[model samples]
Target: MPKIDVNKVAEILKKNELEPTLLRRVMDELRLAVQPDPGEEEKPPPIKKQFVILVSDPEQKLPKDDFVGWVLQIPEEDNVGTTPERVCRAAYDFNDTKKGSLLPVSTIGETLENVPAKHFKEYNTWVKTRTPVLVVRTDNQIPKEVVETEHF
Candidate 1:
């Protein structure tokens, strides 16, 4: 088989009036096409799970600057019911041990609600209608304020 000369091909393309930008783009595409497929061993990073807890203050007891929401990082394999129970227990223990006024885990459990899976707009709407919401989500789904603000 005759060896194809890259310089000769470029010269022919130039002589035929092909634009330099178009040639470059075509070359880039061909180069991409020739790349080896990613190996199975080179797996993508695992998605981290998070819990978004939106606590509402119906009695307006908390300070104005305090956030009502919290984003808690959890293990990717944690049980759905267990993590929230653990959170509630921690909140209860903190209140009981430190002489705080936070609600009991049983009470919080009663108010536990699920956010809609329809994403931001639906979540916003659901939040507007409820108090003390709990939802399991991936890291990407957490709201910016929940992670940045003081929600304790």
Candidate 2:
């Protein structure tokens, strides 16, 4: 595991406009959560797993032939942003990348309701654009060709 840098944590919190006083409380709670008590047995891994999917707008009528791969969120710069020189940075934080990234997303999980209140609008917009539910999987999991056959 990597060491947690307190200064980096503080910097991130400050950049997000969070109060410094909350840092100590969070660190204490996190420390206890990660430490195991004496004689406590290790828990087994989860039997079920959840996944995340990226949805794009179908209204744009993008070509699907060349679209293949995993999707990653792209961050952009704007004025009034988290880093003051930029603007409304958080506004575009959750915005999906262009539909032409040539990648697919695949994973299913319950709608994430724990998103911060500040990102509600952007999150909702994504929810509304359920064009292609791209699936993200390993190279072996992806078939070399999507075959089509005719039946008599």
Candidate 3:
């Protein structure tokens, strides 16, 4: 392979209207995209899309009839109030017309069996705040003011 000068590449990118910082980022991404073994086939990048709704617990100020299901991060049994906190999603039976449904408290390890470890890690990070749970509303249940047609 021919040795290419990084500064020259940056200059060419700048001439083509890409900013230096953007050029660096693009180069970094290219480095990450390169496969180590030349014989290996390139794979498509994983699609990163999710419908995450942030809301307080349904038992609180929010009206109970609005949501379909809730997302929760069940903390570890022994490490209740600690940092680098781990989490798992608790199941909810939406069909049960019961008010104030129970949220199970299983260890984070249990979720690994169901959810991919990569995604669970992201969910765990998202739910670290005081109200980490996500209330997934039904298709038409979200308030009109919060809905934007352009983003959908």
lDDT scores of the candidates, listed in order? 0.48, 0.41, 0.47
**TM-scores, one per candidate:** 0.22, 0.20, 0.19
Encode model 2's per-residue lDDT on 31-102: one tens digit a residue. Answer: 676677978988999797334453454454555444433222324433222232111322234234343123
Candidate 2 residue 118 C-alpha distance from true site, Å: 47
Judged by lDDT relative to the true structure, which candidate is superior, 2 or 3? 3
Candidate 1: Cα lDDT at 33: 63
| Collision count for each candidate, in order | 0, 16, 0
How far residue 110's Cα lies from its native spot in candidate 2, in Å, is 44
- 2 versus 3: better TM-score goes to: 2
Q: Give per-residue CA lDDT, model 1, range 1-152, as digits (tens).
A: 78565556667777888888998776676566656687636768899754455445556555555334434334556554564555454444445543334433344433233322232231121223234334322233446574566775
**Candidate 3, superposed: residue stretches over 4 Å from native:** 1-39, 51-134, 138-152
Q: Which stretches of candidate 1 lie over 4 Å from their true place?
A: 1-70, 101-152
Candidate 2's C-alpha lDDT?
Answer: 0.41
Worst 10 residues of 3 by lDDT: 91-100
Model 3 lDDT, full chain set: 0.47
- Between which residue pairs do clashes occur in model 1? none
